[model samples]
Target: MNTMTLWHITGWEFAALAFAALLVGFSKTAVSGANTVSLAIFAAVLPARASTGVLLPILIAGDLLAVATYRRHAHWPTLWRLFPAVAAGVVVGTVFLLWADDAVVRTSIGAILLLMAAVTVWRRRTADKEEEPESVTTRPGRLKARSYGVLGGFTTMVANAGGPVMSMYLLSAGFRKLGFLGTSAFFFLIVNVSKLPFSAGLGLIDGRSLLLDLALVAFVVPGALFGKWAVHRINQRLFEQLVIAATVVGGLQLLLP
Candidate 1:
């Protein structure tokens, strides 16, 4: 791989980074679905392989802000139950990252996101008429955790595009408002940090990428602040619909040749 020089960052690249960072911040706070835009932008600006590494650090920065904002509302039991499964999924995803073809990864993630969106929409339409009762044990929750975890880890590791996948799962599980934000904040905080080793091992993070991350970090703060404000104003039904729509578009982009 060729090394990028610090001075090589063009005005347009900075613009792109700033915009992507804004989306990251917004996603952290307002609509988690917007991270798909961030993922697409970063991948376009940098090498697809290095984009995840470059964006991960910035994402962690944003995650810190999100946790600080919504820390009080987290559902510890839910997060705890999901941890082991998510961790397992991360390991599996990392292994695949080491060997999978880029095209295969992209298409698989796209298909998964689309399928998840379809399921989520179907469930939502049927939810009112016949609401499913919560399971007795954490088994059902764990299964959900595993399903979302594996898919989240895989899509995120490959393209930093797991936000919608996880969002759909959590929304379907019926977490409201801050609980949803808090849970997402914790989940991604762990997953993004865990991905660092795999990224470093792949030689994706380097001096130039770090410099870019530094520049982008500043944009996330305001974006997150905006997101925090937007959350309260959004209606639940509309939020779910928007999430589904974004997931569909993101998935189609990935699946496109």
Candidate 2:
């Protein structure tokens, strides 16, 4: 396999990646689904498979920041209910990765992004109607959790694009702002951390990737800080619309020849 070194990246490419890294942190702290744009940017800048490897560490860094900020608000019961199915889905995703080539992976990531964006839009339309929070103890709730867990695990493992899916689930469960951020914080941190070995074994994460991550990680901190500050002040509807638009553009770019 060819190794990507800093020398291989031009100044413009580095700038693009740095901006994407910033978005990763911003997404983690403020808008959970917004990172789909970051995912697209990374994949467009790097090889599809290698992009996942490189982006993983940056995401983990953002997750750390998110956990630090929202750790106390996490709903552990919800997490527990989602884990087993997520693990199963991860296993299946790993198998798929083992067989898929770059084209397949790129196409898969594009389709997942578009699908997630559609789900987000649909969820948002019905958001006001879900007055009561969904419960995991009930049969219907358990089924919903299992289905989302599997899909989240698969999409995350494939492209690190599980945020929108998870966001939709939490919203449907009637999570308010802080609760949504807190739960997603811990969820991605644990899941992304667990994925390290798999990514390494798959030759996605390597010395070269780490080198790129080192350069990109610093930008995440400031973005996180900005997101923390802006979360309360920003226009929520406008931001969501922007996120959806960016995700759609990214997905389309990946799908087109």
- State the C-alpha lDDT per candidate: 0.78, 0.81
Candidate 1 per-residue lDDT, tens place, 1-257, comes to 24474346689887987988988998887777778777777766766667778888988988898889888767677777766767776777788878877678778888998999989888777775433322211123566777887777777777778789888888788766676788789888888888888788877777877877887899999899998888889986677677778788888877886
The residue pairs found clashing in candidate 2 are none
Leading candidate by TM-score = 1
Residue-level lDDT of model 2, residues 1-257, one tens digit each, is 35544358788999999999999999999888788788878877787788899999999999999999988778888999999988887888899998888788768867876887788688678656534332221122889899889988987898887787777677656665666788889999999999999889898888878988999999999999988997777564565565567667767776876
Which window of ten consecutive residues has the lowest lDDT sum in model 1? 131-140
lDDT of 1 at 32: 77
Per-structure clash totals for the candidates: 1, 0
